[model samples]
Target: MPQWWKEEIVYQIYPKSFQDSNHDGIGDIQGIIQKLDYLKDLGVTMLWICPIYCSPMDDNGYDIADYYQIHPDFGSMEDVDELIVKAKERDIKIIMDLVINHTSDEHAWFQEALKNPDSPYRQYYIFKEGQDNQPPTNWRSVFSGSVWEKVPHEDNMYYFHSFSKKQPDLNWENPQMREDIYRMINWWLDKGIAGFRVDAINFIKKDQSWQNGPVDGADGLSSCFEFTRNQPGIEVFFKELREKTFDIHHCMTVAEAVGVPYDQLSIFIGQDGCFSMMFDFNYSHIDITEHEEWFPLQNWTMQEYKEKLFLSQKEIFKTGWCGTFLENHDMQRSLNRLIRNPQERTPKAAKALGQMFMFLKGTPFIYQGEEIGTINNHRLSIHDFDDLNSHAQYRRALQEGYSEEEALDFVNRRSRDNTRSPMSWNSQLYAGFSDVQPWLTNNEYYQDINVAKQVNDPDSVLSYYKQMIALRQNPLYHQTLVYGDFISLESEEYVIAYMRQDDQQTILCIQNLQNKETHFPLSSKAQVLLSNDQVNIQNQQLKLSPYQATILLIE
Candidate 1:
């Protein structure tokens, strides 16, 4: 590997929502190809696209119908090849999603497995005979249902699904199945695509016996997080996959890892590693109450958020590489959800948060619309919801005693649909996404927040982000930002402060997360290179206005 991933700014593209090329109201490969220049000008180094593989779109392409083929809605194999060619020309590497934890029930392999009980394909899934009115295991699916769903055709038999029942778990225990997966991965890498963002990668390995899991959370169904996910034997499978596919291309693989223990960080991303890096979810997990099923209704304090994120950055710096991100297809936008008031959500706060994470000792992944302060929509009613996860959480909340209105608030605040909403391209009908109706409703804020306006405005959040990326990639800051050790400046509430330093220069970062002014002194005369707010500095210190931030280079 060329260590290219360490220095890259990864921009995530949700295909169906990114752009509509044919005015068919669906984003396709052609749409992506047309926007390569936009991404290049934005200074993005790599692209992490949500699954474009053949799928039912049940979970928005997470339910894969075919591993190697492009989804008809997106385009054909030829369009994919052209995208790779165009992206590479702009120095933009394309990273596809690898959703191998489960395959769509409609996939040929799964269909064949169901058709013939004696067939070799039968061993390609986790089908078990029911025992004494019990499921194959007591484990609950991540998506609010039972893990095992009965296969009515096969008397007394059931198959496992870690997510939706429409998506059946692949039998990773099957050697043949592993071989097939590797072959598909190699095929993509061979096409000159840079690498992959492996989805639900931790779920690929589980305890062989579907034994009872320990109840560790407030919600009744214990989080299979402890025992079922990232279980002991993952390294072997990852090593094999790496040697067979990723190693050949030196591909950047950022495993979508969540519950992997801090102690195991090095093992997964060591210098001699199983993956180039894995996403650090400490900030996200901070809100995960001791409840298994609830979608964390607890609001986070600013200091708590700071500590969780800083700890993960510090942990990765000590052990191995990590993926730095605030928003993704699966979560709400950071600017909207993280800030208290929309009025207080200034471009300064946006830029500072961008710089704080991007300069960490790892790769930074930017979710779509994060550049120009894309807030989640408030008009979506329960009936308007499309994300299955959001629906499941709403039902779970009602079951847990929240009123209908209360549950609705949870969905509006936390729905993945918040991020999954159609990308706002221009101030047109449906935000210039398409001429026809869109798969999901566009955020109404798109009227003022579209890309066309921000792309040209020097003071826009989009412009600040463009400047931030360029600064990180600058000849002076590139090495420090990519490889510098992270050191925390404080542990107090509502304040996140750190410094990134190499042999040449030391960069001081401070953010006033609260709505109160924060004052702190610095060591020497330092140039304020970046700020989420206007700066006023005096003798060795800086006064951060409410929700303000500053990035300084020491003399």
Candidate 2:
């Protein structure tokens, strides 16, 4: 049951912001190749690069125009081949972002389908006849507005798009289309890439009955999630997808399954499951009331967050595995989200947060700038943002009668663009990400938090990440740390504690989730393995510092 991916530590690269070679102000394959040694030194065993396929840049590469060709902005096929070979040389495997749930409206198939109603490509996407001059169903797109877009010159015809209008949902019900997707996946696997981080995979299957769901928002359209996400009979498509592609090559697949419930974990990740693992957003989105709207933030306590995480861990333990992470391209930085006080978001706080998740009983994923403890960029204007979803949310807030300033503040606090800012490599011009201005603005604090500042500093967040990764990969505790059973530990209100245990040993991880000192009982036989701050222990009682993270081995 042991798998190589299970033991490997993954580092996710948002290529467009990672690095730029040739002074083009755009990050490309060559830019990534230049960072291989840096990743190797950081103790990363695998790299998950976001989509770099040919596209019109509608959804920042998620909307694929050509699955077979690399986007010119990223590089050519030869460059990608070089990247794979180079990464492999450094003991790092690369997994691409597989976005088969939808394709760019500019894709050849969509174009062909748009040009002729009778084209075979027409079946590749979902098209329906309008109902009384309205969309077939009142389903709201994930990005906002109606999920249907009227087709020009085609009488009463509309196409369904789950995310963006430029991104058309592929008809998974189409047998030929499914086979074509399988072939494309096999082609990538054959090219020597490891596998994929499947994007929007849960939305692939939809309700066969096109009926309007109960409207959940003032917009009168129901959240498409009710009818499209993790729908019934989705297992058939999942089974076929696995058997046809992933199983044949034995490639690692992690699905972005948003709406899957705990009771259904078995169908997605165990021996008979569809993927190797899946991301659980229950704890990650604790601050938000819903994934669709950004306003009216939900208040969450450390105890509540701990319970949500423990529940996910317990459920996933029964059926399959999970990918533990704090920040990614889609959300605000971990430091910003976890620490409420802007001044308290320091290197120590970042290390504390990183330590909380790194040693869990699952493969840990480090986002591109997370190792350096990057915080969210604070841009004042909405025009300074690039995420389409941010614009939609701003509009939604206005429609709900919020002031422009209030709406902008909500977007500032929750925008995906907060994490999409260019990665800070050095303190030089543009943070050494590019010779010219980056496509997105650099973080204002990049000068103080760039990788160059902490690469050699042993006390830095970057160094702490390297230490955690080394400990996980160390043969001394690899079996216990990588495959151990996760057990929630009883702790105080502001503390998140857990134990990773096996027959050989038990490792206890305790983190103070707030900026206040607390106390926890420690066993006399426990040996300190790691701590983000100085430890003060006396008479079986340990005094924890503000935002402290401690790992101990029980002998």
Candidate 3:
């Protein structure tokens, strides 16, 4: 039986930049409520909203201070309740971000842990004694710093954090801490939320050895990922987590699980797996180096990207399911990343990329502003950026002997802020995202690419996405589009072609991934179902224009 979640299309909303209702320059629950109809019109079944919990806004609400309270910048709990009820009315389920891997330093548990080393709360977080007046281990944080931060006025005491210093890593080794996390999860599930998008859940379990890894950069500190990401015993915690919370509530879960090997796919996402699905970052991070550094972007070919994506799809198809996403809060816009030629970054190219990913054998996720083909933001200076990771990358690039212009260029091409820009609803003062200045700068191209200009236009990227969604949801072809096997078609390097096959029908999706025309042999029985451009089919040969994407149903 096909799962409901598998057939559902998800839309991710980064609350801060989605829309502002109170003119407070920050997006809120009310703003989301106002956009419910828009999402419904876009045909998404679920909304995976980023964290809106009470926080100091460190890491943009990922450093949660209180799981029970809503962030003031967003709105009160009443607003959230209204949003849930309203979104449900629109047939859209809400999925909140589960960030249990860590908590804000200001969280009561962490504050108590810091106040007295002997407090029971101290056991809730990881704390270690320093050696030789230095951090216990030489592990580097994800945001480019030592993972250990020394305790102020305390003798040789330090705490562990995988990301920001303000976010303390939770000690899953403590049974009590695990119980608390499960309880909190259940509480939210009981509130009528459909599920959760688990954040960095793989980093919860750490290697007990606490050994330093090989230093891969000039910082001398080793990457903490080896010591904390997807360790041996992590499955135990995952099993427990599902049994206690998700399993009981029958909630859908998609994990942001990096470093999970192909062999472990069944354990993480099958029938007995911990999550319903997981996001595969193999193809998404293709432009970056293996170390995930932003500077000196790695050169990649279309074939390489195709191989990575195909491998992931094939492996996951063998075990469980996958979450197909090209853009997220943590990634740059897909239009900017996928289309190499800036001149080809048009509505046609955006529609081509959208159609290419929508029919893959998985649940599709569309990030905010992705429907209208949002592109990367090119800020003039490093000071203009807001993401902590961007600043870290800039400094790291400089430390690696790159000039300021080069560092900013790298940031421009890969910064998370590129996708974090306020959604361009209209050509109003702040791109219709807010009445006043938005929390983040509006993309300069909003004047031409805003939703208001494309909402009703048949040729717009937004309209094309709606058409693709409708095609997927159509009962006549739903079986083949949703549950069919993915078979990669052998084609030229620049052309990506695949067939989704079932016992009844075969749906072929092909794309010209370059800025030049291409030719591919086509079956005479193939019928055009959808296309981004005017494809020429003559004499059993299909002529594809620049960046053309087409879908055909083979009779």
lDDT (tens digit, per residue) of candidate 2 on 1-555: 446778879999999999999798899899999999999999998999999999999889999999999999988999999999999999999999999999999999999999999999999999999999899999989888999999999899999999999999999999999999999999999999999999999899999999988877778878888888989898999999999999999899999887588998888998889999989998898877655578876687778888998998998989988999998998999888878889899898898899999988888999999999998877788898999999988887887788999999888888998888888989999999999989999999999999999989999999999999988888988899999899998999778889999999999899887888999997666888899888888888878998899988987
lDDT of 1 by residue, 232-296 (tens): 88888878878888888888889888777788886578776678899887677555554334454
Give the poorly placed runs of model 2, Cα more than 4 Å off: none
**Candidate 3's residue-wise lDDT over 1-555, tens digit each?**
436789889999999999999998999999999999999999999999999999998799999999999999999999999999999999999999999999999999999998998899999999999889889999989898899999888999999999999999999999999999989999999999999999999999999998778988787888888898878988899889999998898889999998688998776899878999999987889988766788797888889998888888899989999899879999898888877889989889898889888988999999999999989878999999999999998988898889999999999999999989999999878999998888889999999888999999999999999999999999999989999999998899888899999999999999888888989998657889999988688898989998899999987
Worst 10 residues of 2 by lDDT: 289-298
Candidate 3 segments exceeding 4 Å error: none
Better candidate number, 2 or 3, judged by lDDT: 3
The most accurate candidate by lDDT is: 3
Worst 10 residues of 1 by lDDT: 287-296
The predictions' CA RMSDs to the true structure, in order, are 1.9, 1.0, 1.0
TM-score of each: 0.96, 0.99, 0.99
Clashes of each: 5, 0, 0
Residue pairs with colliding backbones in model 3 are none
